[model samples]
Target: MFDGPSSRREFMKAAVAVGGASALSACMSRAEEPIPKGTDDPSSLPERQHAWNDVLVHDDAGNVEGPRHQLLLYVNLDHDGPPTEDDRRVLESALTTLDRAYERSHEGLVYSIAYSPAYFDRFDESLPDDLDLPEPRSLAPFEDPEFDRQDALLHLGSTRADALLEAEEALTGDRDTANTVTMESPLTDVLAVDSRRTGFVGAGMPAERQDVAGIPDSKPVPEQSPLFMGFKAGFAQNQATEDYVTLQDGPFAGGTTKHVANIRQRLDDWYVEQDFEDRVAEMFSPRHAAEGLVDGVGDNLGDSSGLTPDIIESIEEQAKQYGRVGHAQKAARANRDEEGNVRVLRRHFESTDDDVASLHFPSLQTGISVFEEVREAMNGTDLTSNPAIRQRVNNGILEYIFVRRRGNFLVPPRRLRSFPTPTGE
Candidate 1:
């Protein structure tokens, strides 16, 4: 099934989407070089599991580039109620095997394990009042989304498709060895895999896989665009530092809260009806389109999205003037604090899972409330006061995207990652 008339990149993307032992074998056979081995001492690694930016590669413009391929494994505990200490040890051993099997970088593997609110509910004690994790719910009035209540979410990412597949197989006990390292324990020993979702990001990746649903038949996705929307994102200045998002004072200090959402895109109208200028106007701002500030895929903008405080404050005026407001422009309103520090770290990627164009959006912040505030800002419902902008139409990209699922998790620090209790016992 992996064989066809497709580019090497496309072939790898398909292999990841259709993951299994056969897919791993096919990916390994096509690998051009040996996968890098990881460290013997996992203790030296950073305490924060989300610390991937330092080791990840950056573009010529200095923006951090995400892994080429990524997967999210939502799993449930094998048994009921609270897990035993033996369960923690077994899970930790499985994760340690991965650390020993692959280097902690994009070329090897960058991953994290987070527990959901439901996972902590099994305990008698409640999470500290300071922790802002809450049950997942629909954030906008126009959408109804399913909430993911899985016990845990295991995120695995790598530049090499073979590495990503191998790591996953090893964890699920499908393979005893990962990158030639014998697995002492597999995650499946204590957890049952519930759902698996896959995605990718980077230049040429979106264009290569645009033949799926949601995208138009014209293949209007730019060759250099990292996303199907035909633009670059995750600007350095626009993102919060890992330290900023880490829990500063708690038993789970050095950890963070994560909110993951899956949004389906229907872009037939986005590409067919809107021209480049109109897209720029809606994606950035009307002023950006007027000033000709953004270039192809926005690589020329460097470390920032070119959104000024004035532009963010003028969204109502822009909507009144141009009859449209930009997606980034609206989100920027609540993405910053009084000190002007970005409040959330967005690590979203494009997907062709189930032969449909979608996005796996994972956002990290000090608390889940921060993410909700940002999403509310992105909803652009406040701007709907104007007759020109309704709830979905002309209100950012809401018209082209639909929120299908939402989930909130607490990404405990490395030490507390394995079935952590509410009070971080």
Candidate 2:
């Protein structure tokens, strides 16, 4: 039901944000391709719930393309204290219903459930000694973000708009069936949904939704830009491997720590004041702009952001000289381990939730400390001492992005995914 030139593109984006039976019906009517069906066997899925790279669609340059639409369900348990046996069964059946209803891919559906530190406090036992899942906190001297202390977070994603919406409706008891598979149980029966956050990515999406508040009315978003910031991020070479982020030993082995940050964007200055060259300098590095490294939305950089050791190490000097530093260049400082492997797997997406521009940044790592360290690096607080680099000015995209909320969670292994205990047994 869209009427004009950009109807199909805008309809798909809006349908995901406005999820329910009506949105699904509107989307289904316009669906040009049929969504793939899921498997009957839960055993066919991977042990790591965050695992999505293999099934993700890859670009011509070999970069993994994230799902076009995503939904985050913030839920709270119905009862206090530890969960009961029947509660576990109800949650498991609801999850397994999703497995049977859709394939675990971008075309079908990919999902993961994570528990907050507040949820673990309900138990007498503590988390395993190996896991470092501290409660969310303000990382920077300037930021004062509200902490998200919900019991659980359910992340659902797919390229098909109808599939993601249908999965949500099915899980929340809005529908009895999903993809023609009768759902055995609904997650809402065991957990109450506190909030629903939605987002989208992939080329042409940002351009289609630029009429929102954060972006300028000039409509400068490029058609190929996957992010609202006008560049591609989470390149394979720049990201931590799934194995690197997985907890290797402990009761929670194969599990990982997740840190989600909701950042609000006010980008009128980003597009109006700064030209393309200035943006490239702030997003990548002044050297990148000087050398002409990033061509148009950074698609030319291939599978990585192309931040070398020299480029990352020179942020200070660049700040002193050019009066600005790049966001990627500063973050890369703490992004690597002693062995040079990347630290955190960042799966960030753009959102227009509440009619405001924002980003849902979900990062997975072996421990929450690793993510905290990387975020501290991204904050670039040390460089603030320099007269040229203030907190929000000339400090790499910080001038436009504001941290609104933050939360930390422990994503258990698939075996313990359903109402897992602190001990993971």
Clashes of each: 0, 2
Residue range 239-301, candidate 2, lDDT tens digits? 998999999899889889999999999999999999999999999998999889999988889
- Candidate 1 structure quality by residue, lDDT tens digits, 1-425: 44554656667877899999987897898898999999999688999999999989898778899998999999999989899999999998999999999999999999999999999998889999989999999999989999999999999999999999999999999999999999988999999999999999999999999999999999999999999999999999999999899999989999999999999999998999998888898898898998999999999999999999999998888898999999999999999999999999999999999899999999999999999999999999989899999999888889999999999999999988888889888
Regions more than 4 Å wrong, model 1: 1-6
Off by over 4 Å in 2: 1-5
Task: Give the clashing pairs for model 2.
Answer: 38-102, 38-103
Q: Could you estimate the TM-score for every candidate?
A: 0.98, 0.98
Cα RMSD (angstroms) for every candidate in the order listed: 1.4, 1.2
Please give the range of 10 consecutive residues that has the lowest summed lDDT in model 1. Answer: 1-10
